[model samples]
Target: MLAQYLLGKFRALVRLLIQCVSPRQVKLETATYLRGSKTSELDDEDHNVVEWAFSGAYDGDKPILIDAENPARSLSKNKSLDLVTRLSGSFEPGSTVCLHLQNNILYPILVLAILATGCKWTGTNPACTRSELEDHLRVSRSKYIITSEDHEDMVFDVLCRMDEDIELILFSDVTVERPPSKDGKHPTLHDLLANSTFLPLESRYQRLSARTAATLMASSGTTGLPKMAIRAHGALVCESRSDELQDAHKPYKIRRLFCTPMFHAYSFPKMVINPLRQGQPTYYMQRFDDTFIQKLSLYSITDIITVPPILSRLVDQARGGDAKPLLQSLRTIICAGAPLTVKLRDEFIQLFSNPPQLIQEWGMTECGCISRAGDLDADMPTTVGRPVAGYLVKISQEERVEIPGGGFASELLVKGPQLMDCYLGDDSATASHVTSDGWYKTGDVGYLDARGRIFLVDRAKDIIKVNGWQVSAAELEKTVLQVPGVMDAAALSMGHSLDEHPYICVVRTDHGVSEKEIREVLRSQLSRYKGSRCELQFVDGLPRAASGKLLRRKLKAQLTHREK
Candidate 1:
């Protein structure tokens, strides 16, 4: 440990000396460096000056989010800036806005404007059901919702059902007929932007403290409702700046293609900020589908910011000799949001010539990015690398249990500036996850190597990863229990790795209800991914403790024993 510490310090010293002597010029494009970054007037107010600089960092005129529907369709950074200006003037300062639109080019502008106005912003996955969306809206307490004609029906349904006092701001062309406001005019997002004569200078340049809550995002919960996490203004700024600095040091420009939901924290930086700062174009996917391989070759995508399932599909495509030419253009591929199996990673590397830099990042909604493993030894395919810059990692063994690799497996604890303030409106949940001093309990059971690389073994919480999306076991269990004959149900992951499928074990009450009927009921309630590929088992009884709490581990053991 002492030797490793000394070696780390020595490397740091060498880097500092090299930086001092060489003094490399900041070579980032206009989007990263503001033209008027050094203002003489606000020199006295350091926080205000910092805010000005942070806002200005995204002032470039380049296209940020490109429309996937039409390759020619794109939105420039300036258009977003104008919209932000208009939005600031339209809404009260420091107000919270919930953006729940489909993957569109306008998302970047909305995010920037929200941050610039010193207001809080929250967004939900468009795939979320009205009930799920309602839960998020009720928790966040967002009065203004920015959606489009595409999701108008669903959004309106949520609004009507909840009876929450919220305003709808349409971004695209208004196709739905609705009653006008008391002012007797149907106002759209475009109308607001078109009518604005000048920027709302006051709100646009509002001086916000670093600790102010900038984003209130939701967790991909393993149980119950999704927990809201408040990300501070300083945390966002720091992460963006870090990306900028990293890009400055890179030799080649990054033309990233983003298809993940814009609301997700994993996708936000890559989709909106990182590509913008690098002066590189970001192509937004309407959805990840069969057309993805076509887009890669069509747009000459240099980097793909996607999940494991997409990568697995790409690998399968390569095996069929379809993705040879286009795959070469990809220099880097970032996989996150769910675990990437060693089999998938190895196949990806073997299939491509000059294989893309495969970077596996581990993070949750509450914490932006925890660890990223860029370079890994062939033997250590499970390694998630060390903690990212400005984060610390330590394993807190809840119980002394032997691990497979001759070590004790334990829960991973993280401490970082980018860690969330708290789970919004859920004091108990927040308190449980966050320690008294600082450490955030990442409910991931993993072991650290001698070199500090993290290898995940199991989940402390019961969550199923389906195609890189988190499907809560409890949530699925709830859906299964709703079936007519199901007295009790428990959901678990069927596949070992990337082929993860949600499987359910059920205790039936009625004799007439068949497995097919139960499946049909579940299919009606849950999404396609969660409903399909689900294997059901009729169990005589569910393993439970005396207090009626589930003995999941014991049930899993019984199932494994039966399979053998």
Candidate 2:
């Protein structure tokens, strides 16, 4: 295994050197490209036929969702189609639905069912509070919400506060004795599907156009709350059929386990929807656990969809020599959502005798996937590779720093077909993100190599990453302000990449307020990733400009000085 690993690495290095010596343009072949006006190639009259196509690909006895129950329960593709057909009746055409279920078997079926009926959908983070839930509902203006039985009470409370007649569907099979009869409007997903007959009406999907919003994706913001980016049907379709790998000649069989939250853009559309379209199977977990690492062997996982922190944990386990033997079947590992530190990447390569081919991708919610590492001469681990097809990337130099391999540092700007339609109900915000000529300001600082690969340096946005999840510094400051005696607060990132932690410096109005009390209040209000293990410090005051603008660079410098 060690010899094979060395041989593979040597081959990759040779390929990189050869490509560098004899550089060639990777041309976009128009003949092989699949062009469609909508999610499917079917005309308006045949639009409803798309649902049947999904089932037809895997009609035979093939399982879809597999979880790590004592004895794993799997659902066949045919059985899933039946449930989706019945659930389609509950949703109306041209309406938005909120899908907030944790990583459960019902997620993929519910998503396809919503798309089948031409109703737009958006996902909600399970960590959201009632107030955040209310804000998400208001911003998306959804007509229905589908959540697990665990969140029934919270969903009800938030809906009542909204004062809207939104329908609620609890995605659960566990029967509970209610007060003789509950409200007819709020029904369990089991009851809804069991009560309705499977009506395979073609008209249900016919009215949807390519321009219709298929998803209301959330974009992490540096200030205020997260903005809703409206992803169109055309955008999803393009991403689903993206032929980014030029070396592939035939279909590749993938049995993957996706550990990221389903609400994320990468895990949802790329790992779930795209795999479903290709008739591939993906396993799910409510969250990462000890059992999750064990399933790599149990399920014979060929591919893994993961983020940086999870990889860090895996590295730790492998170093202990407990998890190394179980990872033999892994052929590919794709890392995204956060920076993959060079140290971690090298450690992973050294630990496994026959390591999986590591690939890195760089993208944002606004644009589906801009670059893939496989397409460029990725001799350096920091480089994120060249832009994928149908997208163009350029650098807007804000810094004069130049790197040896990666060129001058600047703000990365992009223009692509998969760019989102707009931010929901916020035209000014939409206009601010996108340029008049169509390029979207990614707010990420990076440099482009001569070969077109992008290498990131820093972020222009004031955000911190906790386990690859974006935590807004502004949002943290706002939450800290809610605590009594917190006159002023500022949050900044400490360390780099996945090692980064949210560090807060607070100015107290009252001397009685202790750090423990303030931290307890924050933990209650914010999610665990944002609050639980955050570093807190009492400061005299946060640096600010005369016009009340936060001088974050100065605060960062102060932190540097303190560490020194």
Task: Give the number of the best model, judged by TM-score.
Answer: 2
> Please, what's the RMSD in Å of model 1?
9.6
TM-score of each: 0.84, 0.86
Write one digit per residue (lDDT tens) for candidate 2, span 1-564: 565567567745654475465223432111111111332222222222234336335544577666656324766666666666767766787788999778766677777678778888889988787877887787788899988767888899888878887888877642222332255546777676656656773455556655667888877655557789988776765555553232133234678787678778877665456544556566877888767778888878878877888888887887888778877777678888888887887777666555567888788788877776752344567778767666778777455556443336767788766789889888888898888998788888877654556778888788787877778888888888888888999988887878788899999896446888888877777777778768999888888999999899899898899889
| True lDDT of residue 13, candidate 1 | 52
Q: What is the C-alpha lDDT of each candidate?
A: 0.70, 0.71
Residues 1-564, candidate 1: write the lDDT tens digits. 354345435534543454354212432111110111112211222232124333545547767657766756666656554555665555656777899887777677777666766667899877677767887888888878888767887888888888678888777532222443335223576665555557554556556776778788877565656778988866665555544544565446677777788788888766666554445777888678878887887888877877888888887788877566668677677788788887788777666545556788888878887777764433355777766656677878476456643557778888766688998778898898999988888888877766557778888877777777777788788777777767888877777667778778888886535888888876776667767878888888989999999988889889999999
TM-score, cand. 1: 0.84
Alpha-carbon deviation at 323 in model 1, angstroms: 2.8
In terms of lDDT, the poorest run of 10 residues in model 1 is 28-37
Give RMSD to native, each candidate: 9.6, 5.5
Model 2, runs deviating above 4 Å: 1-60, 70-72, 173-185, 194-198, 243-252, 375-378, 397-407, 510-512
